[model samples]
Target: MLNKSYQQRLEHDLEGWVKNGWVDRQNTGAILADAARGSSSTKIPAIIGILGAILLAAGVVLFVSANWQEISKLTRLLLLLAAMWFTFVVTVWLKRTSHDYLLEAILFLGAAIFGANIILIAQLYHIDNHYPDGLLFWAVGTLLITLFLRSRATLVLAFCLIVSWASIEILEFAQHPFWPFLPVWLIAAGLAYWLSFRFAIHLAFLSFMAWFFSSIDLLIKWSGFSDSETGGLIVLFLLTSFIYGLVMERKNSPLSLGFGDALAHYAISGLLLIVFFFQVETIEFDGWPATLPFVILAGFAAVLVLGTFIARSQKIFNLTDTALFLGFSTWFILSWFIPALNHLWLQAAIYLGLTIWLLIFGQKQYDKLLVILALIAFGCQVFYLYMETLGTLLDTSVFFLLGGVLLISLALGLEMLRRYLERTRDPQDSRSQEVAS
Candidate 1:
């Protein structure tokens, strides 16, 4: 009995040991397999990088060796189609890759090839005979590619294409200028904005450039100083600005508000400068007798004040107001000091009233720029009147007093209403929270 018991116990112990060993081995095998998979995954990025480099090199060679000028028109078209196909294939391959950087680099190279192909095709066919149509076709193709690949680079290319077309139109119109085409350009801008909502930030950036260039083109034409070359240069500047803004926005590590504000300011300033420069000459200064300047100044001031109020109401930072305000100030200083308008006192007064109105209404808006503009306008008004026209002060006293009283009353009423609403909402929120709890 003792011998049998010992054998049975020994067999049971050996079986338990074998089971434990099997469990450990299973776990060890799983860990080793996972490690091996990870090791293989790490190599994918390197492979993608290699492939991207090769494709980029191939694209460059193909672009240079195409002998675009020597090729027949049909041959050029065929080459363009082939280049586009290659780009599409490469883009698809990059999309399937696990490496994002490699994918981005490949997309950029593809975009370059895509743009080059269009330009070459245009050259071969002398599409300038159709003027804007050739550029428009290029824009459409690039825009379609952007939509398909969802590539930011393609979005930029589309923007460049549109701006190029618009610039050509502006130049053509300049020498034999037409009316009513401004609205068409605006439509193009709207299309760009619409595209941005569907695509990436690239479309927004491009739309901004298109709008800016259109504005500049309009300004130049309006100012009677527009030439094809100048319009082309403006288009180039618009692109440069777009690129600079994109780079700055991307590079900002901590993402300060100031950088974004500055960029917005730059864009707005560019747009306003274009508008003011174009319209300044046609303002009918002699007939209006200072009315035009006052109107212009007030228009900008109103835009600033209203824009601030809307921005505050929306609870977002909107630099449009600041842009318009700065633009107006620039025009005021330039127009006032350089040409030295008659009845500058009235213009200065109008500007001051508008500024004071903003300060009182927009005090709660948290925008430092708006407040500064108000102060500047006030100081300019006081200085101009006190130094330049002492007699006009007496005449304008009633106007200033009435304007100030109205603005102050409106500001106080609005503030009181806002406080009341906040106080009422706070109690309600607390009660809801208490009930939920």
Candidate 2:
């Protein structure tokens, strides 16, 4: 779907094209009208249909709950089968009728019902075994339906089920369960790219990130690294994400899997957010032997800094990009020695500074995503500060007063800068287009 701003820009450009005799006004209007009609299918009807599906599924669950004890074992099994078949049949009918929104809704409902059936069936039969098996069943069933219907919505649901299943196994086993997850995740990624399911692609990336972090953490623990050493794993994760992002951007990765450098973008953003949350506390080590992880941390930091510089020289890394990587590395490396930097106040100050710098850099680059990330970081810092406040009247008053003033100033400055950039970029863009034409 087109972003609202982009949609507006398209309309504005279409009007200009109409005026310039580059396109017929009536034809442009018809094209826009067609797009509007197509988009409407995914709006109200889709919402209402999804809500209806959820309600219907809830009602089924309620019925099952009410009659579960009275029903025989076979009857219970038959009931679940009937529900699945009924939902599938309705989905097919909706598809045939070109009720695309309702079809998607029914598919989602079917997945929910299928998962419920997996758990309920196991429970009713007293065949309760490992709990995650239910999730595996749900994942497989959902994925089959996704493949059959070629539904992006169902694909997302299936991927979530798959990820959840893997996470459960990891937690339950207290180790990385790479056996099923690795192959399953690869299959999910392949399907996401093949179907061009953008949300599914993102889910796949997130699932991989979780798996990667968990695997690294498990490996570190197994290798006799103390819990204090896990920060090194995160540093490594961040470095790998940056390097991968540089590679992906350099390759000009295909859009079939959706946005380019999606893994890197998510990994970097997620790792930073995680660090903000947990970096306030320092984990102490016992002796010099425990300091081994810090050596690894330093190595990763150096690699990140060196790789970023190389990327910059190759034009893959912009100034803002280099600064971001180095900034994160600097903060992490400092935490290794100046344990006091993990103090709440210092962390808040660093986050605040980082957010402000991001705002300025994002404006310079005209990067809306980075600007949004900066805003989110600012919000996070504000929330963290509020949580950390001493709650004394004077401190509370001062905190609110300063925070309110700073936020207002930041908002106004960002707005003015964005407007200025928009105005300046438009003229340059138009001139470039004219020259190209």
Best by TM-score: 2
- Estimated TM-score for each candidate: 0.43, 0.67
Off by over 4 Å in 2: 1-31, 34-47, 68-76, 86-101, 109-113, 116-120, 163-190, 206-220, 226-229, 239-252, 261-265, 274-279, 285-331, 337-353, 376-437
Put down candidate 1 lDDT per residue, 1-437, tens digits, no spaces.
55456555645665665575534544544644554555545656655764675576466546645665665767766766676577567667756784454654565556556656666655655566656766676666666665566555555556666666666766664522333334434544445444543333334444555555556555656654424234323423432342243334444524322244444435434533443343223333222214444554455445444544444345342354444444444444344233343245445544555456446434654546646655665665565455554677775676567767876887798789889999999999889878977
Global Cα lDDT for candidate 2? 0.73
Find the 10 residues in a row with the least total lDDT in model 1: 280-289
Candidate 2 lDDT, 315-359, residue by residue in tens = 766786678757766776456445566776667767777677666
| lDDT, candidate 1, at 111 | 59
TM-score of 1: 0.43
RMSD of each: 18.4, 6.1
